[model samples]
Target: MARPHDAPSARELVAAVREFLERDVLGGLEGRARFHGLVAVNVLGMVERELDLGPAHERAHAERLAALGFDGDAALAAALREGRLDDRFAEVKAALEDAVRDKLAVADPSRAG
Candidate 1:
């Protein structure tokens, strides 16, 4: 038994549209239309990934910032620019790398590696 609202979650809807674009629409599109269609599909894929990964990523980012003794990105950036984190450069670098990897995971899994 499935309720109408319970079926086809937002992520599922995005996936369905992305699949349709990739499988049906892309083949029929040509020239600039095809290019735009591909772009739309890519954006939809990013949205799907964000829906799947955003919450976990948000938590991890906050944790990383806390572990680095910062409240937010602006604070962290200010500290770095002030050379306050120079002694802890390696730790900062690792945290930043992890952050970038997480972003890439949502933006483009292939590039996340």
Candidate 2:
């Protein structure tokens, strides 16, 4: 009865988790309790979900590079042909994560406190 998905719907799943945590786990947030508390926990779950598959993603990247005959130590040597690894997929992904701190600060300025 469920439609197929190309990948796990992390956003929807995280949103649902947020709602669950807000309503059930913490329950009627009061006193010092805040909704933002759940954001930290839920965001970390999303981050860990991403990190847990990093090795697989790296392996796939290596495989692709190998298939393209750009591999191993030789690939490191030939890396200049593609130039700076700083902008490579892996680096871009890292930068995206780094950007999160800034974005979160923008979203919740008090988070900087």
Candidate 3:
């Protein structure tokens, strides 16, 4: 999902670098350095997941919001604050939870489950 100038693909490039860091860079280290390397690898994994899931997540979020008759989170929040949605709080809660779960799915699928 890159433009013509993107060669090996963004996800591929990030994955390759993550692999290198996990294997080569972390292999030689210990203590805090290793911990930091692990964190870096985790960050890279998040980046790759974001690249992979961000688009679909956006689309799903927009569709969900449209179905709920809200423009976005701010509009939904305003409605909640004003008690405009009090009659349908259960439906609102389910939709909000689903939205959060979807976000968590992209940010960390394991934790999302």
Candidate 4:
């Protein structure tokens, strides 16, 4: 389906700025300035990835939570802390790992791999 916006959506705009910073601004900077520019580029890249992956991640997270018999993270955490899921430790661990993987996929794709 088409996005409910005109050309140059948020993700595209962020990517453009990131590319410009990397290609034009970073090249002319030094020391702290260059480091900050690179940081900005990395942040924008994460934003782009989040925009692309957030929906699917949300769905997967919900499914994982459901499989663990919880409705949300808060509930899951509470259950874990209360030892309610002790008997299902392996299953819970797997679900949490999948959740973390999904989060990392958007927050830091390189590390996620």
Q: Residues 1-113, candidate 1, lDDT per residue (tens digit)?
A: 66568768999999999999999889998999999999999999999999999999999999999999998999999999999999998999999999999999988899999
What digit string (tens of lDDT, one per residue) describes model 3 on residues 13-107?
99999999998899898999999999999899989988998899889888888878998989988988999989987878888888898778867
lDDT of 2 by residue, 16-58 (tens): 6766775686666654565666665567555544545446646
Q: Compared to the true structure, candidate 4 yields what TM-score?
A: 0.94
The Cα local distance difference test for each model comes to 0.95, 0.55, 0.88, 0.90
Model 2 residue 6 CA deviation (Å) reads 35
Candidate 1 pairs with clashing backbones: none
Candidate number with the higher lDDT (3 or 4): 4
Name the regions of candidate 4 deviating beyond 4 angstroms. none
* lDDT score, candidate 3, position 40: 91
Clash pairs, model 4 backbone: none
Winner by lDDT between candidate 2 and candidate 1: 1
Best of the two (1, 4) by TM-score: 4
Worst 10 residues of 1 by lDDT: 1-10
Candidate 3 wrong stretches, greater than 4 Å: none
Kindly report which residue pairs in candidate 2 clash with one another: none
